[model samples]
Target: MYQYDNYDQAMVDARVAEFRDQVARRLEGKLTEEQFRPLRLMNGLYLQLHAYMLRVAVPYGTLSGKQMRMLGHIARKYDRGYGHFTTRQNIQYNWIKLSDAPDILADLASVEMHAIQTSGNCIRNISSDQYAGVAADEVADPRPWAELLRQWSSFHPEFSYLPRKFKIAVIASAQDRAAMRLHDIGLELVKKDGVIGARVFVGGGMGRTPIVAPEINAFITEDEIISYVEACLRVYNRYGRRDNKYKARIKILVHELGVEEYRRQVAEEFAHMKALGLNPPREELARIAAHFATPAYESGLSDDLDRSDPDFALWVDRNVTAHKQPGYAIANISLKPIGGIPGDASADQIELMADLAERYSLDELRVTHAQNIVLPYVKKADLYALWKELEANGLGEPNLDLVTDIIACPGLDYCSLANARSIPVAQKIASRFASNGRDAEIGELKLKISGCINACGHHHAGHIGILGVDRKGTENYQLLLGGSGAEDCSLGTITGPGFDENGIVDAVEKATDLYLRERTEGERFLDTYRRLGMAPFKEAIYG
Candidate 1:
């Protein structure tokens, strides 16, 4: 995990102090809600339906054991003993008091974490693949570059106010776990002619108008990434729609300008920035890279370790993945319980995970985009014992990449923008599929639920996407077919009419059952859908 340097530490400490003063002023009636809204948002505080929600950024989803423990402490001390991990690889405390937010920021800063730019119109947290450093197929780790961008964008004077919020994701692997195509700016690390480079995708995003990202440039040299990104931002900041908030995202800009014109404008801006010497400092990048070198590895594993346990095999198969190092595995902790809330971990669960991360795995933890926790490096020989501990703590759910692994948003229950309750919808759908006893039978189906058009649940990328809409004050869900969150990502197509809350789960089951019958041998839901197209599933589901 990357620790904060003097500059990082100093900036956060100052922000905390400043926010503390701002909170005092607001409470004393010196600042109005309108006056204080932007300030609070910049500090990651949101005034939600019933209370204030504070979002804490877990950069590229990586956390130290100590940092994880501190989050648990904060959950116990300031919140309702739980936190919700979001799609952007961040955590949200939904019941924070306005008065206690500054103290929360201060505590987080002490642990080398801060909520800065977790919200508002500035460049948000720079995200990368959760398996960045350890994935065997990676061309290079993308976290150092993410951190470098984080430093450069933090409180950037020019881009602080944009037409709307912006997001950026970086990936260094052939597999796109971070959903790079769904971001405003997506960068893929590549190598060309013996030189390291990046493939840049600008004006790619998801929301009401979902567009699969288009390639702006196939290969951008490593030295030009910063300037190129700045160019993209400048073009958007200048030409994006400002009349309507819904049309302000970079995706809309891409839609209106057409890909070619957008690319040309960004290129023009990049040349100008280069002429002005506005590129990110290479020395600063080198400094950030030093903080994320590979962790210390032990030479040998115990020869007398148990390997025949069925529980161990299940855990190894479902919760663990291949690691870059031999004899080690990357353990993924599923946040989805059969019918439980997605991404909500109690304080005790958090403590137990922190303990496990420190004791068995490397002293590192990560929150994943799929709303799960990851222990990046666990020894294979220790799988059984670790599984036992995790089961005891209610954190051992071996359902990764399965139907129960649902991605859901905190819908009408918390979000004012939501049209319906997403969590309950997710819970019911998960329960229905579990009842059918076909969770494993279905295999590797991503079911995403979003409450509204914002697409926070990434409904556009699910193998089966459910979108909640307000139909005459009644909760109705619109089904979409053939969405995929993979290397060849595509937006789902609408199936038919919306279903009521209770009817929605059954509808999803119908779709899945259709897949079980129509799929070719050993084919995933996505492959089956592609092979047969949306018509087969749509006819089965709708009819």
Candidate 2:
């Protein structure tokens, strides 16, 4: 994890002071809601349907044990007893009081975390693979580059107030674990012929108009990434549509301009920036890289983890993944249970995870976009005892990439923009799937639900996507099929009409049954959907 330097600490402290004054002014009637809107948004504070929501950034989804403890403290002290982790790997407190926001920011700053860039139409938090440093397939850790982008983009005068919020994700390997294809800008670290570089993909995003990202260029040398990214942002800032909120994302810009023209424009702008020496300094990047160098690994461990305990075996089989190192494995903590809320953790649970990170694993933990916690480096020898501790803490759920591991949004419960309650919908689906014990039989599947078309749940990328809409005050869910979250990414096609809230679970069950019956053995729902198309699932779901 990157430690905050004096400059970083000072910036956060100063911002807190500024916000403290702003909050005071708003309370004193010196600033109205209209006046304080942008100010609050810039600080990651939102006035939700029921109360104020404060979103705190967990940069690149990394959290130290102490930092996690502080987040737990905040959740317990200020708002509800729990916090919701977002798809971007940030956390949101849905019941915060407007008067206590500055205090919350202050508390977070004490732990070297903040809400900066977590919201607003600006450069948001930089995201990377949760399995960055430990993944077996990784060529390099992408966090260093992510940190560099974080520093350069924070409060950047040139691009801070862009046409819309900009999201960037970097992947360090051939496998797209970070879902890079769904980001505004996706960078893949690559090595070709002994030369290190990045493959840049621009103008890829999801919203009302979803587009699978198209590659702009391949194997751009390491030195060129910054300038290339700057060029993409510059083009978006200049020509991205601002007249309509729906058309403001870079994806629409790319669609309107055409890929060839967009590519040409980006190259021209990048060349100009390069000539002007506007690229990020190599020395600065190296400095950031030093902070994220691989952690020291302790050699020699037993892989003979106790599999006698069914729970332990289930966890080992489902939650833990192979690590690049011989003795270590990555442990995934599933947030979705049979009837549990998705992406939510109570204050006590957060504290327990933090403690586990310091004790059993390295002092490192990552929040995944799938709304799960990942202990990226746990020794195989320590697996049994670690599982015991996790089980005691209620953090050991043995479902990874399964139907029960749903992705959902705050929906009407917290988000004012939401049309229906996503959490309940997610919980119902998870329970239904688990009770049947058909999740493993169905194989790896992604079920994502969004409150609205904004797609915060990443419903567009799910193998089975559900979008909730409020029709005449009645909640209805629309199902879509053939959606994928992998390399050959594609948006889901809608299946028939919207279903009533109760009908949704049945509809999903029908869809899954169709896939199970149609798919060959060992074929995942995504693979079967790709092979057969939407016709089969649509017929089963509607007919």
Candidate 3:
């Protein structure tokens, strides 16, 4: 929704020109693969197992129909006919050619988009609640702050190369839809005594070592948030480990220093930064905030949906959320359709979604970290028609947060770093639990699979986490239980030894069976797991 000004346009155009020259040099053999690795990575290009992968940033997960159309174009023209929407709300093209990298970026730049900082050590894309402005429970829209941070952090010389990659997420609702606590830095917009402020959470991450960030500052005035975040990053950049990549994330530093010491260090740095005038200017924030102004709504529109159609009713119940605006609802377009790939959208599907957004959703849509799309301002009266269009286009799946709605990474199918295949595992699991009645009976289970310990699938945050590993040159899978990626964030624990692929699927089914047998009335899988702990589930899986 935010349009790029002349300055933003010029900066992106210049970057495109620079990258084009770099790509040309690489193709001409003036730069070797080793020499081009960092350069390409800085632009969000990666050499995967089969081909080059390009990750494009979707800032704060907000995009206009125009931008979405461009993404569809890129998918069709440059890479494969489809693209993978990632857990970070970005999109990755798994079959990219090195020579087309610059051209793809240029096309992105035309729509005020880029791949910058999507994969580098510098601050990655700033994420926020996909339902930021429209959520009924929102205290404030977090996008203005997220946008401010994005502008401040892009190409910041001081943070160009940190010990490891950094991520930031902001949320305004009590429900943590953005997985706030799992980010390197998480900001919760809070209002106390009628004054808006930020509740800062620091050093949270997921990889080999998963950590739920501890609150560093319970309240910092909104005006001083930029200063506080800079202080925290400075502390991590100064003392975060450089010797070992495994120990380089800020979470490791927080664990080693203890939360109290880390808070103390951040406080000291905050004071120093404040004295040095690092706080962003109020005028600049105002300028960014202006772009996020609420859209005009028609008066006297009916809030009721014509859900006489049973199919429409089911979708409305499963995929729609209450909007703050009268007669409006936030509709989720589920990417996970039964046994289909979790987040893969064909170019035509993307274009269709863009057209629907333009026609019905105020020309704007938000990408969820759950790998879904949100038409945040759809009129209730138009729900059935929208559903019909989406259904015809294969974008309408009523499975929101269901068993078949699994989150999986590229794994060995694409990622060279992966030790095992995750896609097939996810597909198998989804297919196993494909029964609609079974999904409803099970209720609200999150199954996440990662090819390796890198945890890109966010396995550590799922209610049922599966990590694929290689044991004696054979693919094996490990199970983790009781994890969640919400406001009450918690890391999952591994259950004993790893199982083979079929064994893992059977083990998951067994766990589900145990949950169904043991659960009390209205207890979801996560609730049951938390109430009973991992003992019963562990015994059920292993026994």
- Write down the lDDT of every candidate, Cα atoms only: 0.88, 0.89, 0.92
lDDT for each residue of candidate 1 in 1-543, tens digit (9 for 90 to 100): 677778779999999999999999999999999999999999999998989999999888988888888889989999999999988999999999998999999999999999999999889988889898999999888998888788778999989999999999989998999889888999999989988789998766667888878899999988889889888888989988889998999988987899999999988998898899987777877778888888887767543436587777776777888888877888898889889999999998888889889987788888889999988888877767778888887778888989889999999999988998999988987888777778979988999999999999999999989999999988899998888766788999989999999888888888889888888888998888889887877788778
**Candidate 1 weakest ten by summed lDDT:** 298-307
- In candidate 3 the C-alpha lDDT for residue 239 amounts to 97
Worst 10 residues of 2 by lDDT: 299-308
User: Runs in model 1 with CA error above 4 Å?
Assistant: 302-307
TM-score of structure candidate 1: 0.98
* lDDT by residue (tens digit), candidate 2, 1-543: 788999999999999999999999999999999999999999999999999999999988999999998989998999889988889989999999989999999999999999999989999999999999888888888998999889989999989889899999998888887789999999999998988889999878777988888899987888888888999999999998789888999999998999999999999998899899887778988888888887788966666666778878888999999998888889998887679889999999998989989986788889999999998888888888888887877778888999999999989887899998898888888888888898878879999999998999999999999999989998889998878767768888888789987899999999889888888987888889888887878788888
What is the overall TM-score of model 3 with all chains considered together?
0.99
Location of the lowest summed lDDT over 10 successive residues in candidate 3: 434-443
Per-residue lDDT of model 3, residues 1-543, tens digit only: 577999989989998999999999999999999999999999999999889999999999999999999999999999889999999999999999998999999999989999999987899999999999888898998999999999989989999999999999999989999999999999999998998889999989999899999999999998999999999999999999999999999999999999999999999999998898888888998899999998998779998777789988999999999989998999999998876888999999999999999999999989889888999989998999999999998988888998888899989999999999998888888888875377767879988999999999999999999999999999999999989999878899998899998999999999999999999998889899999988898889888
Query: What local lDDT score does residue 520 receive in model 2, on the 0 to 100 scale?
Result: 90
How far in Å is the alpha carbon of 471 misplaced in model 2?
1.9
Candidate 2 TM-score, C-alpha based = 0.99
